[model samples]
Target: MTIPKELEKILEITKEQNTWRRKETLNLIASENVMSPVAESVYMSDYMSRYAEGKPYKRFYQGTKYVDEIETLTMDLMNQVTSSKFCDMRPISGTVANAAVFRVLANPGDKALIAPVQAGAHVSHTRFGTLGALGIEHIELPFDKENINVDVDKSIKMIEEVKPKFVVMGGSLYLFPHPAKELSPHIHAVGAKLVYDAAHVYGLIAGKAWSNPLDDGADFLNVSTHKTFPGPQGGAIFSNNEDYYKPVSRTIFPWFVSNHHLHRLPATAVTALEMREFGEEYASQIVRNAKKLAESLASLGFKVVGEHLGYTKSHQVAVDVRPQGGGAKAAKTLEEANIIVNKNLLPYDGPEAVSNPSGLRIGVQEMTRFGMKEGEMEEIASLFKKVLIDGKEPSQIKREVMEMRKGYLSVKYTFQDGEWEQKFSSKVIPMII
Candidate 1:
């Protein structure tokens, strides 16, 4: 029997995207990463066709014994890597994870303080996203323009004045660390809980290259299992406080998520083991690549953000592309040249400029997953210069970009076949590298 026309079209488009994204172009999107073949193989198991509601041992379904084991193992490995006492891997996405915490931390019409939008407050933490949908009042903390971070002194004052129910820190396009350590106390003083959205930096935190917000007194750590973590696309919430975590765990189930995407558990477990074995090197290289790329961009006359604070401690590099006629133009031009990055809003950009802003959000996590290091970062920066500053033809640069990409297509920082097969059968979690 011949394939139907619609099915044929869908198949064609799927293959095209798989080839283009995997082998043709470099991916610089801060929010994406590739899963390893080992974990990916585990991803396409019987779990995809099944369901398991509620916790591991106490599932609300019957055909869930294996999934229950997989999920519990995933949570245990995640907890081991992140050093959290309580873990909930039920939220299917980072936003959902944030929503669960936000729900438990405050009621509708209640107030919450978030990191200044200019300094990287995720939309979920603001009145424009989940907070608005939930009817929570979101107050933006003040920015320290000189340091390109939240103004701790002013934020403390605001936390006291508003007496919010929760305070959110960390976000997209964030270059430096949020002041979680300095502001956690003030957040608690207002009868509020501090939440750190580590979605962007979870890998770094677990790898010991970045600070764990739990140690900084934050009540919760919300994360995307992907991103710098290089895991499957899912989310988990972790906390030392049972009161906070238990409620959020309940919220994740009956409210924000239902199926919990059973397939993600085995894949996530494999990724967590990979992080335990190789994450220190991978996370360290990501930071080095970000800094090197920023320095290279600066040398090429691109305005790299946070130049005074050593460019970046995380895997992201924020740049002002206004001279190249704003981020939209730069991002489009780069895309034409087979380079991938996103147009983003700078702190100074008004909410009205959301469509096209002065900033470009470039991340090293994906390229780092492909094993591109500091030297490749410099090469990438030169390609940016050639495309944007030198007015080189995009088609010509696209050829060079493709050629460079040919050398780095396979995923790195993951288990080799022989190594993983042995580990996959065992109950032991690897010691952190």
Candidate 2:
């Protein structure tokens, strides 16, 4: 059968993205990862044409037999990866997943105990987040700057006083294992459900590299597939308590989300199963690389966040750049040299605005994926010192930055295979340059 020109044009457009993939630079943002090849294939597979709403194997629309198998594998893989009793692998993203959770759990104006956005809380749990516009009240819990973990005593006291309906246990930045076991009992004492947002550390938890909130007394868990977990952009919610199954699914289906994205579902399910196989080695190395990088940056006089033991036990590290200039300027300077990192707010900022804050967040996942290790982190830290601390010209550092990046060419993905390296031959659109 001859292919239609319209479908041919769409394929050409996809080919353009394939062609341009290699020119893109570093993705150092904390909440991102390179998905596996099987995940990538299923993502762009013919399943994209189907619409399988409702639940797996049971669809309102027709032609869902194969798609049903995909969804079943996705949910089962999710269950295996996190050891959860139940899993939902379709919220579009982590932010919207939290929105679904709030829809099921809270009413308008219901108080939510959460750490502030400026204090490393994910955007979904703060005033500027999805829940904020939904009329949920937010109560900020103070954190300990020294340890970079929750001040459990202070948080519990505040929970006792506010008695919020929900308590958010996870933050965007993690330097140590959360005291979930200690905090969960307190939240329950005040009749609050602990909703653990594990978007940043889901893979680590899957690999047993970090604390498992579900086992530690979290009533519900929300996570993203991209960060830590090597999957496409999507969100999920799971619960051991059977009561949440109905309300959570109802809110996600008819209330908040209409039809889940079928294209993302198959890829996500495939990636979830891949994580079950290769996630331990990858997740462990991510945390180890993070620690090494943090230590190296600190040794270079960069004032990296956290203190002893590299100030982190996960896949992220933050450096205080305000003494040099500030997070915004430093980020822009680094970007000029083809290095990418984001400006973030530190808890001790006292009263700094969220935009263009004082701290810089660095991630080790992508660099680790590129096969760079502790020595490379040290060399890169020196380069950072040259630009941010020593005030050298960015142009001088740019050459070295390019060389370092070039040296760490694409390594073989244990799970993704060689599809990522296959460059597209045809470009629908001409090169921009």
Candidate 3:
């Protein structure tokens, strides 16, 4: 097929420029992941043309019969993946899933306990988030420095004192597994419901890497697909109880969104099914990679957050970068060398702005998925130390990064004997290292 002159020029530019850019950037962002070729293929299908406006059974637009199937399949996959009685795939992002939970569970003035953003809570549940703006009282959870987990005793005291309407657990930078089930009884002592934000650990849980929040007695659970789940960018909500279905569906539909992209649904559903089969392997590898990276980084005299395995029960590893000019300067210095990471705030950070905090949060998910194991992590950490500790030139580091990335040909996951599938396979889940 001959390409038209006009489209050909655009294609040429896209192929020459953006393609290489994607190839070069070493994505260590904890919340991001490269979707399988199969997942990407589904996004570009005819389903993308649909404009369904409601749930699977009913819609405001015609030609939604197929979209209905896609929605149902997505829901079923989410249920299986999370083991929830009610799972809704309508929320466009994890934030929206959380919003839906807040809408259904808390009144305008009701108090909702959450971890402070500096303490590693996501914005969705923080006082800086929608929860605070919508008249929902925000109570920040405390962490135990010795154990690096939520201080359930302190939180229980706060719950009794505040009488919060809902108690939220989990966050973006939480390295340790949340004791939601054990803590739920304490929250209920003050008539509060437990909501677990499993965004970071969804893939880990599916991989049997960490315990599931639902099984741990959380009433509500919210997660994003792009993180450790290794799926298309999307969000999902699952509940231990079926009664939340209607309220959640309502909050997601007319109240929060309309015509939830049918194209994204099929892609997300396919990703979910893939996760159900191969997620355990993928997720376990992520943890193993993180563990290796943390150990390597710590061995280099870097201040790693959790010295123990359970302290970082998932993929994230946070390092205090203040000794090396804080997170902002460190991030810029590293980025100039073609290495990417984000500045973050630690629990004990004494008043650093969110944009320019004192720590660097790193992850091994992308590298792990790309087939880089312990040795590679050690190499990356050595590079990191050389650049930061040895004071190597930023440009010199970029050249090294370019060479390092070249060794890994592509980001796509491969199957048996190079017969690579375009999407994730639930059965291909990797074992924990």
Candidate 4:
């Protein structure tokens, strides 16, 4: 019994990445998270090999009874967590979720207002992405630079003037809550629907650490399950509005998605149940850690954004890294030191700055799941300063970073037993192999 050399190499690389990302490095990428061992185990089930297209109990394929039950359970858990009357656990990714909603709500030539790219709108909401593919006219909502949110008065005026088919709220670089409450009434008055893409903060809302956009008058809530939600890599749409349920669900299957990745259902269900139990504490600590990280970075002369608004209410913190050779260079340099982050466009960064944006987006949710706290956030900021400000060698910083990560290797706030390695070895890895 011998493994092929090429296959061996692939396994080696995956093992390396698993060890590097899971054990050694500090992940600050705002869009990333680690699933709990229980969820991870479920993610590797035989369901991965199956397909259950269309909705539960009505599938295009047979032999889907259990799959249907799992999906139904998952949707039920999603409804419970989101407090929405209807939930669809289908769209394979966040962008796909956006596409389904767009397909149902707007015609090809209809106008849709979205948060500006500089203000954190995901590409799916812009002309360069899905909206463009659908021939929908995408317009930017006015952004208030000093406040780091939508220009409510101007946006309301724009909504009246343009009268778009729908207005999209929420974005990837979200800091504070959007003015959904303020603008929803205005959006509806103009005969437009309000949609919130809560991909980054879905878990926060579920945990009650942030406001639910549905509660703030949004007609639909879309999310990617992987980010702060700590589920499988998939997407979901939730809403209380009965009118949207049938159309949106049908659009999701025959139009935007097929098969729907049945494996994600049980994993998502487990994560949803876990969130119901530990999400409040996990989400609260994530925000607290983010605020502390922002303050520490600002104190270290990093020009952290949104200081006047108490840094952040979510899991993210943004820093202007132009002073230390710009975000592109700074992010790469941090990676060399085993600290992961992504370059992002600040509101002031023009379209030309997309390739070399002046800002870095950092999220503390994964680390918070690893049981790191406010004090640890300060230490992480020091690591950033050493690498970016002091111009210390990244190799030197990497050693210290690895040492610092030694104690906080276990994933917390879930129903897993013992240290992460022990739990993975005894429970997840054995089951998978």
- Among these predictions, the greatest TM-score belongs to 4
The 0-to-1 C-alpha lDDT of every candidate, in the order given, reads 0.90, 0.77, 0.78, 0.91
lDDT of 4 at 87: 92
In what order do the candidates fall by TM-score, top score first?
4, 1, 3, 2
Point out the higher-scoring one by lDDT: 2 or 4. 4
Worst 10 residues of 3 by lDDT: 424-433
Which portions of model 4 show Cα errors greater than 4 Å? Answer: 418-433
Model 1, residue 239: C-alpha shift (Å): 0.5
Per-model tally of clashing residue pairs? 0, 1, 9, 0
393 in model 1: Cα distance from truth in Å? 0.9
Q: Top lDDT: which candidate number?
A: 4
Tens digits of lDDT, candidate 2, 11-95: 9998875433333345577877776545665577666666767887667888888878878877888898899998887687888
Worst-scoring 10-residue span by lDDT in model 2 = 424-433
- How accurate locally is residue 91 in candidate 4, as Cα lDDT from 0 to 100? 93
Give the CA lDDT, 0 to 100, for residue 44 in model 3. Answer: 72
Q: TM-score for every candidate vs. truth?
A: 0.96, 0.88, 0.90, 0.96
lDDT by residue for model 1 over 1-433, one digit each (tens)? 9879999899999999998899989899999999987787778777878889888889889988888788888889999999999999998988999999999888899998888889888888888899998999988899998888999999888889999999899998778889999999888887899999999999999998998999999899999999999888999999999987888888888898889888899899999999999999999999999999999999999998889889888899999999999999999999999999999998789988888999899999999999899899999999999999999999999999999999998899887667666876354333332
Flag clash pairs in model 3: 38-422, 207-280, 277-426, 277-427, 278-425, 278-426, 278-429, 281-429, 281-430
lDDT per residue for candidate 4 within 221-315, as digits (tens), equals 99999888998899999998989767998898788787888889989998999999998998898889999999999999899988999989999
User: Which model is ahead, 1 or 3, in terms of TM-score?
Assistant: 1
Q: After superposition, how far is residue 22 of candidate 2 from its true place, in Å?
A: 4.3
